[model samples]
Target: MRTNKQVYRSGPAATKFAQAVKVGDALYVSGQVGMDESGHIPADLAAQMQLAYVNLEQVLAQFDASMAHIVDEVFFVTDMQDFMSDAAAIYAARQAVYGAEPAVCHSLLGVSALALPALKIEIKCVACVAHESESHRAKASR
Candidate 1:
């Protein structure tokens, strides 16, 4: 059986594939890269990671969700050695993005390449979104 899904698309890849898709309480986000809306990518890994998180946030916002809703994530890096060398800066940028230690399952993998060779990293996420009513009730309880 097919499941009903809500899809969101934007930027250059709009016709390529949805940036995110929601089915029930779960939102599946596609791999987000450091490329900006104008297709500019930074050479620094940390800068790229920071931009990628911003892109991820935009995708989540399309679903009325946020990074807090994220339950799992995967990071695909083109160069593991280079990534590790800059891991501190990258993680620091991530911490700034999340505002706290993110509570989520995470995986990091070294990949040979991404859709764009200039891209050093891609971040994919899965989020658990509460229904409107449930969200309201939770806020009320708090």
Candidate 2:
């Protein structure tokens, strides 16, 4: 069976689409932007990247998953050159969360603009529910 859910915060505008859907063991996360729970974008690229990842984390957490469960990621940025540092920072953060495996399937794209003016980065991810046999899940429980 499949399940769908919309994620939102108190003061933020309602999400335009479903934040995540779970089909069997996999979770598909919708595109997440660099905005806070109140929908305000941060000023710097690094901050925006952090915020975007934070949003992604929130969605994943709903499924009892974390970045360690992420098997794929799609990243979008307005200016590739200007955002490389921020991208690297996000990558580092992912390394901390997922160790090495979650870095494998990643795509980066240069986009004209995001849905919001202040959003410089957006990210989407796909993750699996932690199986009892998974090593990562064992580690997380410790």
Candidate 3:
């Protein structure tokens, strides 16, 4: 059986995996790293987390979704000790990005490494979009 889905690509543009995939109303965003388009990786963990969220947001925009649409997320960090050492700063940065406490399920896991040696963190997200008809109805009511 074939399932309907949409995919968005970034990074090398020739990589085997897509940045995000949308199936029906649900979107699965691949793990986003701190590396920017110019391939710069910041040293600080909080800085890295912020940049990763920026990358994730860019992917979400491709599907007309935003952080508000995200229902779940998983954070993979290379150094949990370092992460926990500055949990306040890291979470404060996150709260700033979300504009408040994120109303979503999430997990944090310590990893040995990422695709790049310099990378410290990667964030994966899952988002839900409103059905087209529902979106239209909401717009009509407004």
**Which RMSD values do the candidates have, in order?**
5.7, 6.5, 5.5
The candidate that wins on TM-score is: 3
Whole-model lDDT per candidate: 0.85, 0.72, 0.85
What TM-score fits each model? 0.89, 0.74, 0.90
Off by over 4 Å in 2: 1-15, 85-90, 97-101, 130-142
Order by TM-score, highest first: 3, 1, 2
| Model 3 TM-score relative to the real fold | 0.90
Candidate 1 per-residue lDDT, tens place, 1-142, comes to 9997777767776898988877888899999999888889999888889899999998787767888999999999999999898788778778778889888999999999999889999999999987643442343355
> What shift in Å separates residue 72 of candidate 1 from its native position after superposition?
0.5
> In candidate 3, what residue range of length 10 has the lowest lDDT sum?
131-140
Flag regions of model 3 displaced more than 4 Å: 131-142
